[model samples]
Each structure stands twice: as C-alpha cells, then as structure tokens.
Target chain A: MSGSGPGPTAVPTARRGRRTVDLPDLVARARAGEARAVARLISLVEDASPAVREVAAALAPHTVRARVIGLTGAPGVGKSTTTTALVRAYRQAGQRVGVLAVDPSSPFSGGALLGDRVRMQDHAGDAGVYIRSMASRGHLGGLAWATPQALRVLDAAGCDVVLVETVGVGQSELEIASLADTTLVLLAPGMGDGIQAAKAGILEVADVLVVNKADRDGADQTVRDLRAMLTLGERRDGAWRPPVCRTVATRGGGEGVAALVEAIDEHRRWLDSSGERARRRVERAAREIEAIALAGLRERMGEVRGSVALGALAEAVVAGETDPFRAADVLLAQL
Target chain B: MSGSGPGPTAVPTARRGRRTVDLPDLVARARAGEARAVARLISLVEDASPAVREVAAALAPHTVRARVIGLTGAPGVGKSTTTTALVRAYRQAGQRVGVLAVDPSSPFSGGALLGDRVRMQDHAGDAGVYIRSMASRGHLGGLAWATPQALRVLDAAGCDVVLVETVGVGQSELEIASLADTTLVLLAPGMGDGIQAAKAGILEVADVLVVNKADRDGADQTVRDLRAMLTLGERRDGAWRPPVCRTVATRGGGEGVAALVEAIDEHRRWLDSSGERARRRVERAAREIEAIALAGLRERMGEVRGSVALGALAEAVVAGETDPFRAADVLLAQL
Candidate 1:
C-alpha cells in the first residue's frame, strides 16, 4: 500500500475490478476545501472501510491542527442552538468550520431530525461548512474509535475549528473530553443539571462551563450554583480554572456568543502558553493509537472465535473441566 | 499455580507475607452452604484479586447449574421490590437463592440505599438467601468483565436459583441479557417507559415481559401497548414467545408471584426441551472466555503505553509524520 506513494502526479485510482475509489484524488480535493470530498472522506471513516488506513496516511501530511471544541450536556440543554451560534460567530471571522454530531447512545442517525434541522439549515448554503451525524450502531469500539478519525478528516480538510457535539451521559462524556482541546460542559437553569453533572463527573473535564438559555428563569441561581461547585476544588496558583459563561442561544443576532468565544480563545491561549496544547495533542494521539491496536486485536479474536480450539475450550468450560481464566490463557497462547 | 491441586485434605492456606487465603477451604465451605465463604469468594471476584483464578479453578468442579434469571428495568420500576418478593417465594419453596444487584452506572456501591433498604431488611435474617450489591467503579471492562465471575461464585455455592438485577439502560441492558438464562424486562405503568424501552432496544432481549405495579391505573394500557409492539415482530415455528405477566409486587400474599414463577419454569422447560439451555451455557462461557482474553490483551497494551516506543510514535503522529493507524501497527509489531 505504501508503494503507491502520495503526490499530485501519482496514479489517483487503484482499481479493484469494477469498483474504484480514488483515495489520493479524494484527499487532494478535500485538502483543497471541497465540501463534497470532505463529506465523502468522513463517510469512509464512519463506515470503517478497508481503505481507511490509506486515507489516513494520505491525509496525515495535510493536517493543519484545527482547534477541536467539544460541546456536551444532557439532552435538553440547547446544545444545537449554542452550536449554531458558535458556527455563525466563527463564520463571521472568515474561518471554515466542521461539525460532527456523534450520538453514542442512539442506534439510528436521527439526531438531525429533532428540532436541530432548522438550526443546522442556517449553514446549509455555506461552502466553508461541513456537517455530519455519526451513530454508534456497528462500531466495535463505539465512539471512542470513530470520532478521532472524523476529527482528523476535518482538520486535514482545512477547517480552522471543528466542533464535536454529543449527549453528556455515561462514558461518552469522558470520551469526548479526551478527544477535544477545549471541552465545554453546557447546562441550563431549572433543569436540575447541576447535580446530575456533578454525579456524572462532568465538571472535572470542563475547560468552559456554558449556561445556555440564559434568559430563562433561575439563570442567576444556576450560575451561582456552578460557582459554588467550582470553588470546592483546589487548583494550583497558575492552573487554568474553567470559566462559567451564560448565553441565550435563541436570541436573534447571537446574544452572549461573543463572550463565550472569547472564553474559548482565552483557554486556547493558556493551552499554548503553558505547553498544554502539545501535551494534550500527544496524549490524544497515544489514545487513538491504543484504541486502534486494541480494535485490531479484537478483530483477531473474533476470527479465532469460530475455531475448533475455542470451541473445545468453551465446551471444557461448560463441562466444568476448566475455568474461563485458564481457557483464556490457552486461547491467547494460540493467538 | 496448577501444581497445587484441589483436594479435601490438601494444604488449604497459601500464605503471602501478611495475607493468607485458603482457596480450597473457601470453596469447600462455600459448597457446604456457608454464606460468608460465598460472600468472600464473590468479594475476591469483585476486587479482581490475584487469587481469583485459583478461586474460579477451585469452584469449577462444584457447579450446580443454577437457574440464572435477570431482572432489568429503568429506575423507579420497583426492581428491588420484585427482587425481594422473588426471594421470598424461592425461600418458601426451601430452595437456596442468591441475588446480585449490579449497578454499572454508579461509581458507588449504594444500590442497597433508597427504598431498597426496607425491602432488603426482610431477608436479613434468612440463611438460605444471600444478597449483595456490586458497583462497576474500577473494573476496566465494566460489568461485562466482573458480573460473570460473581455469578460463578453464586452458582458454585449450590444456590438453586440466582437473580441478577440491573438498571435497564444503554449497554447494561444488553449485557444483562447476555448473562441470563431467563431475562425479565420489567416495565411500570404511567411512566412513559414503553417508548423508552423500545428506543433502548430492551424489548428484543426479553424472554419474559413483566408489567409490575399492576394495581395502578393505565396498567391495561401498558400491557396492551407491549402486546401491540410484540406482535409487530415475526417469530419462527416452535420459537418461545415472551409471556407478558402482571404483578402487584407490593401487595400482600405474593400477588401474581405464583404465576410468575410458573411462567419462569415453563420457559426453563422449553429451554431444556429445545436444547437451548446447553446452547446458551456454551455461548455464555465463550463470551466469558473472550472477555477475559480481551482484558488480558488490554493490560498488555497498558504496559506498553508507558514505554518510549509508544511515546516516540505519539510524538511522530503529533508532528504530522505518521497517522494513528500506522503508529498502532508499529506498536502492535513491538508487542
């Protein structure tokens, strides 16, 4: 595969019979800021296609280090609205943006159908914007394995900032935090989200705390509650404390969006100045590599699952002749 | 480890500095109907202790093929009440019973708190019943890695029946279904649980559908909705259709308890007659073996994670000289 080499003058298509995917040409188009090519690349990644390794290798040299901002909260915290506002704010600054709405809990890709369409349609005509929704229906490693590849696609496609939005529940919250440079944990007033967030351990992952729908009742009380929670933790003298910002995302003309953007920018500055950006990037890369290796090992195990050796071991276990741990050792030895 | 064989009069205790655990004696006592020994064996499994392999090996020959029944539903669905009632009925029949309340979402082992304490107190004095709560706080593979070992502990302790109850949510619902011989998906009336169950794909795993809180209003509506949903799917000839049962669990005189037990017995007969019991057992054992193997592989990867080879690869990826897939391949080759 590496012998093909990646360059503009190289053969674009490696044809396998009648089916053809010009991965090199596709990567070239995506790097040239073509939305269709970018969407197709993301589709390949989401599908876990056989050529994904080739695509990744092709896109590696084009990565521009796009800023990744993760937005997560409970189901009804105005995540889509806040995301729309952020997109508009970024577009106003003439920056290309990509959005990946990852739903690890849902088996279907219907995240775009639930009152999010109208907001997302605002970016439908922009050539500089690419939006996609990925569901964890068939993924073996689920969101943790897929999201980073999608993010890499956006970064190599010349996006200045890529926003990843997901429901803040269970393991997905922490998974998102690990993949992003700046993590925003969104909440709203009168939703009892403060207690739930704390219980979920969502507070520790936040680089910015966003209280969307700030015009609603008890917004002040919500901000005060967040402040109280923040003060309970001790930080080093120069450590970056997550800033709590309030926004009425439904208001016309993007009310309170400027301050939120400024907060993100400030966090980015801190990350760069403290050498935390390089550190986080290296850690994320390490995790991505580890996930891929584990996935390969799992695939190998799945292949061995149908072998007579495993069948005999399983039968021995069922017959009470051997324990699972011993059977596992035998199976691993065979692998 | 196998050099020390299990026997009646073999050396019981294996001393390691300040700690001593007698695996053969513990298994012997557990098989002779000692509740404390059973509890200690399960604690070893829960803690993922080094002696767990020995415990599993020692307990293998004493397996009694206990009936594994899984109870799962959303919170506030009276799971604890039904569990207590089932325990009472089983004990009244003079059968030894065990209950495992596995909470995969909670970081704390407080499954016995809330209103469950009052119901659980009814069984505190019974020697034939053993009840314990396990939280998936520190396990690398969550409930999937830990639950089966705990179940094995109970099964080898000569319990005629073991009830495994868990909150029916995203992944845990499916995990519980995989571990049970008979899975009861519980629903309560007027809770909007029907739609949620359908969305979570919880209905497909049920061998028995239970509508608890049968005395409440809308009980008939919930049952009808469940029946309507069930009929939408097609089943093959001789296939066992899940029976929908109603039970007012809080009522005195074990309301509907006899009928529920009868239904479970009927399902068990079908499983035996159709050879599915053996099939399920073999499949369950296969899964347990696979989970153990994957966990062992994960530990090896974790060890390699701190090595300089992985660090260099991660740095190369961050510098855009390599992709994660290629880095993962290099790491796996090193392994």
Candidate 2:
C-alpha cells in the first residue's frame, strides 16, 4: 500500500525510508558497465511511486535513444530460437542487447516444460547481454504491469536493442505492439487455416514476418499461404511490405537476418515519410507521461471512490433514479 | 472527432438518445418477438454505447430462464453449421430460440465464399426464432461492441434460449466468454496442433467442448486429446466438466446434440446446487452496474471531452511531456 498510489504528497517532501530511487545516476552507473545499477533502476521503475515518476520523467530523454523490438508468434514457432539469433545478431554487430522472454508456464509444474527460462540461459555468461523471463501475469496487454518500465530500465541501462518476446496471440501481444519500435510476428509453416484468424488486429502490427524452421517440409505451402493472406490483406498504408523471411534459427541457416532489420530501418523512413509513425511516436511519449500522473490518482484520494453517499449515487444510477452525470458530479464535488 | 473521452461537468440530462437501449431491454424485446429491433439493438450493444447502457440501466429483474450458450473454435470448425443444427434442434423442440452469429468477415470483402451471414440465413424466416449477424468492428473483445446490449434486446424480446456464435480463435472470443453463461468451444479434429496453442488461454473458458463434423477423420483423436488436455488442466471451484461431444453438424448426424443440451441443463442445476451460478449472476450484476457508470461518464462530460484540446493533449501525452493526471485535471478543472 505504501507505494500503491502516487507517493504521499506530504511525506514525499521528506525522502528518508521512501526507497524511491535516483534512476539518472543509476542509469549513468549502468552505462559505466554496472549491471547491478541497471537492475536497481528497474526495481525503482516497478515501485509505483510518484518519485519513480520523477525519475522516469528525468530519464525519459535518455531512454528514448534505444531501438525497441517485439518478437511474437505461436508457441513452437522457434520464437526463442529466433530471439536467440536476434541477440547474437545484434551483439555480433557490437550492440548491447537485453531480452525479455515472457511466457506463461506455471511455476509449480516441474517437468520437461517446467522451466522455459532455460531456453535463454545461453546469454548467462555473455557480457553486453542480459535476459529475463516473465509470466502471463494476466496483464491483458501481454507484458507485466511493470514491463514498460522494465523496458525503460533497459533503455536507461544503455541497451542498444531491447527485444520483447511476447506471451502470444492475445491482447498482451497487441500491448507489446504499442511498446516496441518494430514488431516481428513469427509464424511457422502448417498453421494453414489458423493464420486467417491471426491476421486480424494487434498481431498484424508486425513490421516483419519470420517463418522459422523453414527448411522443414510444407515450407513452400506455408509461405504461399502466408503470402496469399498477406496479399489479400492489403497493408492499410502499404507502409511496409511485411517481407517474409525463411530462417532455420536452430542451425542459424539464414544468417542474413539483417534484411528484416533493414525493413525496420525502412519503416522508420516511412514513419518519417507519412509522418504517421512520428505522430505515433509522439503519442507513445504522451502516454508515458500521463502514465506517470495517473498511476496513483484515484488511490491518492483513498475511500473517496468508495464513500456511502457515492455508493448511493451509484445505486441510483443503476436504479434509474438519477442520471450518471449527477452521480459523477456528486462524487467529484465530494472529492 | 465525434465520440471521445469523458467530457466536462457530468452526465447531460437524459434527453433523447439515452434510454433507447441496454442488455435487458434487448433481451426483453427479443423475447417479445421483435426481430428488426433485436438486430438493431444487438448492433447498439456491439457498439458499447450509452444507449445500450441506458437500456441495461432500466433493466428489470430477470430470471435465469434462458440458457446463454456460446460456440467458438478456429475458423472452418463448422461453428456456423453446428450452430445451425443446434438452432434446428431447438426449433424441433418447439422452443423459442435466438442466435447471435458473430461474423468477423469484413462486410466489404467480396469473395466467393458465402458471407457467414448468408451461410446462417437458414434461421432467417422462422417464426419461433430470431437470428442476428454481428460484426467485430475492429477493437475485438468479441461480442461486437453491441453484443451485450443486443443480448438484452433478445432477452426482452423473450427468446427462451440464446446462442452466441463467435470467432474461433480471435480476441473476439473473449467477448463471448464474458457474456455467455455457458461457452461451447468447437474444434475440428484436423487442427490438433493448433489446439495446443489455443489451450494456453481461451480453452479454459469452455463449458462444453464440441468437435463438430464427427464424420471427418481424427474426430476420435480430437475428443481424446481435448479430454486429456481438460484433465491435465486444473478445475475451477464450481467448474462443470466440459463434456466433449462429437457431432457431424453438416450431415444431420448430430445425434449427440440433445446430450449437449442436457449437459447444459445439468450444469444449470449445478449452478443452483453449488451456488456458483448465483455467484456468477451477482458478478454479472456488478459488471452491469460498472458498465452503466462507465458508459454514462462520457455523455456527462459533453464539452471538455469534445474540446479541440483533446487532439492536442493526445499528441502531448504521446510526446511524454504532459502527465495524464495533469491532463485530466486540466480538462476537469474547466468544469
């Protein structure tokens, strides 16, 4: 409860025991090769405190420099393999990378699939590389409540490329679409009819279409089907061709993954061309700012949202006694 | 430009457009034998409008008279066919029936495949029936924005039973899950691998597992797989055993259809005996009340929310310069 809402307005004036962190200094420390400092900054961001807002506000300019990418698709589509390749690709290019592999495997279920986190353990020893695992956590937007901030932590930590691996095919993937600079939708062959269902909303935000394990049988049919679907489903703006790439991520067969990277670069150009992407970027910024203020607004007025008279008004609204307009006004006036 | 955000002040006087709808009224109207009213009203709910809220707000006490059932699966699972058969079964029973078929197929698409609406035209002229085609107008929680409101329309119109046919695998199914009392997840045996992917999130919402087109190969395997998956998955506190039923909907070989209906009846008794269904009804009531408040909030803030500043603030919020609470404060402060 202490950090639930915006920090206490009065107590906020005094800093002791608040545990609200100084992210800018930590960010600088992390940039100076201190992983612990980067971790501390992420902890602060997850802290739901107004002071954290102040830190985020101060760090926003520094954080926006990194390129954020979201990788998503069906399970068994080699997203982990693709992600590992991505990390290697970026690291080979001398860029620091951070990876968040978010899947929903129950912690209590201990077996073959018990710990998916191990798929990412290859990054354990690599310098200039950081990887973490997250759960479904029921965050409808795909990431955790603290995910965007965690991304900001990486952003602040000076990771050149931050990759987000989504929980798959839900609203959360859509949420990740909004969070990343480019979204790569990974689809394997043999989904046949399921792709029609997948082409609809947030999943379509992908800047690149990755067909992993393409060396397998039915690759051509899958590619043809995907191409037909993509063709029939004209890009709303033709902003990007949504190029399909064939990759055998396991053997690293398709080493020229740089083409997909180039597509993202071209998308940035299109963003500049139509100015829509720039507008989108600007919109993202505003959301981040507003997120700061509204994080604890209602909680700041605790019990106000649950008063007796207010409760009566809510019932009246329900009972058709008075309009909801009167109800909200009465509540706002009380506040 | 037209409909956005909570406006300043509060709810305007319930002038003209307000009281036209809601879930209960639509439900009542549908029960009263108003087909056109039912169609239009379903749309109103699908839109998630205040009109729906108003109608729902004025809702009277409703008995647990109707069996609200949902049919869902990957596309091509013959949900539409199964639904048609299910309706035919109800018609055979001489019961008043309602079907809300969700058609995510863009009305604009001119393909050889009969529009889902046309495919479902079988129930069009029945005196004892009402049929509606619902479109997922973009943002997909599923019940079309108008579904709940339309459901009310059907209820008031007096359909003894209501069936919602939803998209198999889209986020739109979530809409049906939230609205339906009993959800029947339809699957074709061939899409076995796809089933594993779906089992992650949408599967657990099923009250009944339907493998339509039982004449098709892999029918037995699909049933067995689903049963194994169901058992491997955890059970809810009052969760009904989602009896997996096999039916060849296209062939009129749906002999097992009656048992599916009986399972629903059995589940309803469980609802009463275990008190879980009552708990759900109470929860739905709470949700209905919340929806009312949420819908009326925007109409109340007529001016400020409609202001030019919104366009500007949207940009600013995206820019990360202005905090959303401060934005709300400024907007509200105008009142």
Candidate 3:
C-alpha cells in the first residue's frame, strides 16, 4: 500500500486478477482536469467501490487547493438559485467551479431534480463547470463518509472552487460544516423563516447569513430579525461575525451576489490569518477518517448482527442473562 | 454483567466505592409511578452516566408496554399546541401520557420552552401526565443514542402512551420514525409548509399528515397540496396511506382531534395485524445496537486519535506511505 516501497500497482498480476481497475490512470486523468475522470472517481466514492481507498491515496497530493463553500437553508430558500448565481460570479472571475448537491431526501433517489438543479443547466455547456448530486440512499454514516471523498475528486481535478449545497435541516448540515471553508445559510423573507432558522439551530453554523428573495415584502424585517437574533446568540471572542446580506438571486443581481463572494473571501482570509484553516482541515480529515473507520466496523457488524454469537448475546441481554453494555463489549471484541 | 450469574448489586463492595446509585431501588420507584425517580433515571441517561447500563438492565423487563408516537413539524406549525391537545384527549381516556420534547435548539437547554409545553401546563395538576424536554446539545449520535434510553425510562414508568415531540426538520425526524409506532407530520397553511415538508424529505415517513391551524385561509390548500404530493411520492404496497386531517388545536376542537386519534388507533391495529410492528421494532433495535457499538468505538477512537499510534498511522496516510483504509485498519486493530 506504500507508494514509497513497491506500490500497490507493482503487483500487477494480483491487482488485475482481483479488481481490474487502472486506478493510477484514472488519477492521472482526474489530475489533468478531465471531467469524466473526476465524475468516475466520485461515482466510485458514492458506490463505495473496493478501489476507493486507492483512489483516495492517489488523490491525496492534490486535495488541498480548491475552496469549498457550503450553502444550506430550508426548502424554498432559493439555495439552487443562489448557487447558480455564485457559479456565474466565480466563472466571471475565471474560476472553475464544481457543485455537489447533497440531497436530504430519500436514499432510493438520485440527482438534483429539485428544479433548482434544472436552473443550473446554464452552466452545463461550460467544460469548466461540473455538477453532481449525491443522495444518502444506503449510506449509514451519511454525508460524513461520502462528501469528503467527492470534494477531493473535484479538488484534485483542478476545480478552483466547489460549492456544497444541502438542505440545512438535519445532521447533514453539521457534516457540511466539516467539509466547507465557509457556510452560507439562506432564508427567504416572510413565512417566519427567521424564527424558523433560529429554532432549527442553523444560526450557530452560519458564516454568512443570506436572506434570498430580497424583493419579498418582509425582507428587511427578516434581516433585522436575524441581526437581533445573532446579537442574542452567543459569539466567540474575536470571531468573525456573520454578515446579513440580501439577494434576489433569480434576477441575477451582480452586486449582491458579488458581496456574498466578498464575504466568503473575507472569511477565508480570517480562517487563514487565525490559523483556523489548518485546524478545520485537520478536524475534517479526522472526522472523515473516523467515519470510514465506523463504516468498516458497521460492515463487520452487519455480518455478525444475526450470527449465532450476536443473537445469543441479544437474547441473553433480553432474558436478564447479561447487560447490553457487556453484550456490546462482547460483540466489539468479536469484531 | 449477567444478572443470572451474580447481579451487579451483589458486587456492592466493587460498586459502592465507585458510585452509590441504587439501580433496582430507582427502577422500583419508577414502576410505582414516582415522577422524581423517572426524572432521575432520565437525567442519568442524558448525562451518559456509567450507571445507565445498570439502569437499562433493570428497566428492560418493563419497557415493552408504551405506545410511542412521534409528533414533528416545522417551528411555527403549532407542534406543541397539537401535542398538548392530543395529550388531553389521551388523558380523557383514563390513560397515562408522557411527553418527551427533543429540542434541536440546544442540548444543555431542556424543558418545554417551545410555548406549546407552556400550554401543556393545563395538565400539570393531573398526575397522569408527565412532560420532559431533552436537549441534544453535544450528542454526536444525536437522536440515535439518547432518545431510545429516554423513551424506555418513560415506558417503564407506567405510561400507556408517550409522545416524542421533535422539530421535524432534520435527521432527528428519521430517528423519530424508528422510535414511534405512528408518526404524525403536522403542517400549517399559508407558509408553503406542504412544499417545505416534501422538500425536507419527511413526506415518506408520515403515517398521519396533519394540517394544524385549519382555520387559516390556506388550510384547505395546504391539505390539498399534501394529498397531491402524497399521490406522487412512492408508497409501499399494502402500507398505510397517510390521511390528511384538519385541526384547530389551540381551540381544542374535539371532533377533528378525535378523528386524528382514531387514525392513530387504526394505524396501531394495522401495525399489529400486519406484523409491521415486530419488523419495525427489529429494525429499530438493530439501529440502536449499532449506534451503541459505534459510540463505544468512537470513545476508543478518541483515545487513539492524537495518540502515538494513530498519529503515526495518520502521518503514513497523509504522506502517501499508506492509504487511509490500511491506516484505519491499523487504528481499529489497536482498539
């Protein structure tokens, strides 16, 4: 497995007979900014293919370049519109953009069919843009396991910026935080979204608070409400205060969208100056590593779950023969 | 750890010096309908106290009776108000009811600050009702770990029906599905909540679709939208079709509320008659056991994370000496 020694590829006969994947070739193609190769690597991550570990290893050297931004909010918050506008803004600045929409819907589903993704087809003609949607269909470890690897694919494929868009309402929101350098929380005016945002606990993670659909009647009031709420919420000393910005994303308002990009840049600058970038990256890697470790253990546990040893232990726990903790220890020991 | 061998109580010399908790005594009090004892036990679970394993062991014999119903919706959709109304209806039938409000806002924050809990104080004088709020502040396993243990405490405390209320906007909603015998997805008209519900990916988990605040002008529209969405979403053959119901919960409308209860009872009967009850329970237990196992491993991983062994492995993986898979294998082997 060590590249320093005889690489995993050195034993060509053993590798070819087993998996038959030219991992090195794929990695080279991805590094050369081939969209198809990047997509293939992400597909492998999504599918949990056997060669994914090798892919991760191959892509490690080129993983840290792209700026990853997370966009999240409740339904109808114009996440997709904002995402599209941001893409255009970055493209105007001559940056290659990648969009990874993490669907918070059912696992049996796929793609960014959310109508917002449909609007993003404006970028489809540009080879410099790539869009992918990932669903947590059968993923037990959820976004914590899959998103990082996908981001790595885009990063190594020479994307200048990658936007991670997810519905900002669950455990996945936190996972997005780990993968992103900046997180934008979008909300629409009216419908009591300001209160909803606070209640849903997304306020704490917002690096930039965006009230999309700024032309709505209550947009100013919502912005005010958010500012007041942030004041009441605790803030760390010397921490960057999340700016409240309004944007009518559908209208392609350039200044508002550019301000958002500026906010992201400032946050990135702060992250760098405060030494939080390396800290966040290390934490993200640690989480990704732990998620992989847990996923592996779960696979082992699945095989042992209904085995005689586990069933007996479960029965013993139920029948007052043993405690669940002790039984759990026994199960882990077996693994 | 096996009760059949020598119970944890028999090792008083070993236990008394470390912790003086009397697990059997507390369990007995909880069974005798002592709210204080129940609260104490739940506090232990929330605190993740070591004695919780013993508490779980003692209470295991009494946990199967309660019918747990999970009620969730957006923040201002009157979840708390509807919950209070339902609790009153259940209390009218001479049944003991317990409420566990899973607060996504903050983990250190507890109790019913959601205003609906304040309304539920209408039943405060009634000894048959128990209300507790749980905060998911720092729990990494989120609803997967703390909730089940808390539900068990309420179940063993002689409640006939336990209402597990959570703000239904995230991964906790799915966790609630596994815990509840029936799930009610509450919506209010006028806020595009129906679309939000669908977008939140919670539509698939709804056993009962409730449009609260039906007096609002868009109440009918919301109900219609939900029905249309349900028509389009996939449904398992022979599975219960969620019925959309209207209710003005704060006014305590009897007939509408009664119909909702009837739908719940009908669903409960279907669960029993169709054996879905057993199947869901099996799946739920599997998830819980797996969560517990992962939690244990996380504790082990925490110890190993920055330690010499894990640090060395991480260095190897980052420096391209080894892939993360093999590095993870090394870490797990040490655990």
lDDT of 3 by residue, A1-335 (tens): 01232211100111112346688998888878776667677877777787788888787766467889999888788888899889888877899888888876757333436553474346545766777777765455588878888888888888899999988766777778877989998899886478888887788888999998889899999999999999997778978899998898889354489888898999999999988876677667666767788788778878886787766665564454655566677878888
**Candidates ranked, most accurate by TM-score first:** 1, 3, 2
TM-score of chain B of each: 0.89, 0.74, 0.88
DockQ of every predicted complex: 0.51, 0.11, 0.17
Rank order (by lDDT, best first): 1, 3, 2
For candidate 3 chain B, the 10 contiguous residues with the lowest summed lDDT are B7-16
Q: Which stretches of candidate 3 lie over 4 Å from their true place?
A: A1-19, A23-48, A54-291, A298-327, B1-19, B112-120, B138-140, B192-196, B224-238, B252-255, B318-320
Off-target runs (Cα >4 Å) in candidate 1 are A1-19, A69-144, A161-177, A182-234, A241-269, A304-309, B1-18, B71-94, B101-133, B136-144, B165-174, B184-233, B241-260, B304-307
TM-score of each: 0.78, 0.57, 0.62
**Superposition error at A95 for model 1 (Å):** 4.2
DockQ leader: 1
For model 1, residues A1-335, the per-residue Cα lDDT tens digits are 11132222211112123236899898888888776677677767766788789988987776548999999998899888898889889988999888888877676553334534564456655666767777755455677777888888888888899999988877888988888999999999988567667777999999999998888998998898888898988998888899999998889966899999999999999999999989888888888889889889988899988678888898899898999899999999887
Pairs that clash in candidate 1: none
State in Å the error of residue B319, model 1.
Answer: 1.4
Error (Å) of candidate 1 at residue B287 is 2.0
lDDT of 3 by residue, B1-335 (tens): 01232211110011112357788898888888877677778877766788778887786666356888999887788888888889879978889888888877675534536453474446545667777777765454577777778888888888999999888766878888987889998888986477888888888888999888889898888888899988987778887888999888888344389989999999999999989876666556556666677789778877877677766665564454665667777777778
What are the clash counts of all predictions, listed in order? 0, 53, 2
At residue A49, give the lDDT of candidate 1.
Answer: 83
